[model samples]
Target: MSGYFIYASLHQGRPALEIVDADSRQVCLQWEYGHSASQQTLPERDNPAVDELSESEIQRLFRRLLLLSCRQSLHGQDEPEQNS
Candidate 1:
């Protein structure tokens, strides 16, 4: 996966961060959100034609993205208890 291309793809108004290997297969490290999107900075989503940033920058971005997803999932877990 060293030469794999990591890209942000959109489908049905959602955002998906994909890593495709040299064989054009989704090898590993895929990220996505249902009903949400990939943002450049904030309040935006799905930059399909964006250029690739630095590796360090991408690492930082993905770390933040994972953290946010965890927080959102925790929030959703609380909803069932509240409704009950």
Candidate 2:
């Protein structure tokens, strides 16, 4: 309850997954889909203290995002993957 939580929400009218700090209730990372899928850091109105997060915490967030992506693919959403 004192760490980060992942939420499925909309960011700028697009489907998004957000990693929010439970204590500050601020978004630290966001993965959103629009013309393409992309990841943004500190997408909220005010930036969260991203520097405070440890490397493992950040990795956890990315792992969760990957898991969600895999699930979406398994469901056959027809979303195209973008190569950067």
Candidate 3:
């Protein structure tokens, strides 16, 4: 794990955060968030991408996702939460 890039996109029609191998452009990990549940997947590897990331890096990624989610809510893209 030399370096990785984090970005936001839609995975399976839901918002997701993705970590990709900078050199190979391979998606090393994905975290898809939905209304009901969130899914995290680590692609097959001896050392997972998440393990390579520092604690600060992981925090920053989560912060970025939070900001994106807030922006979506402001723009009315996010659906209203349903009371269970």
TM-scores, one per candidate? 0.32, 0.33, 0.34
Among all windows of ten consecutive residues in candidate 3, which has the lowest summed lDDT? 34-43
> Could you tell me the TM-score of candidate 2?
0.33
Q: At residue 1, what lDDT does model 3 achieve?
A: 35
Model 2: residue 2 alpha-carbon error in angstroms:
31
Q: Write the per-residue lDDT of candidate 1 for residues 1-84, one digit (tens) a residue.
A: 124466888866556677655444645456554322444442323554333323344565578557645654765632444454
Q: Please write out the lDDT profile of model 3 over residues 1-84, one tens digit for every residue.
A: 345588888866656677775667887566654322332444344655535443444565577667656654675645665699
The 10-residue segment with the lowest total lDDT in model 2? 34-43
Candidate 1 Cα outliers beyond 4 Å, as residue runs: 23-26, 35-61, 64-84
Off by over 4 Å in 3: 1-53, 80-84
Model 2: which residue pairs collide?
Answer: none
Count of clashing residue pairs in every prediction:
0, 0, 0
Better of 1 and 3 by lDDT: 3
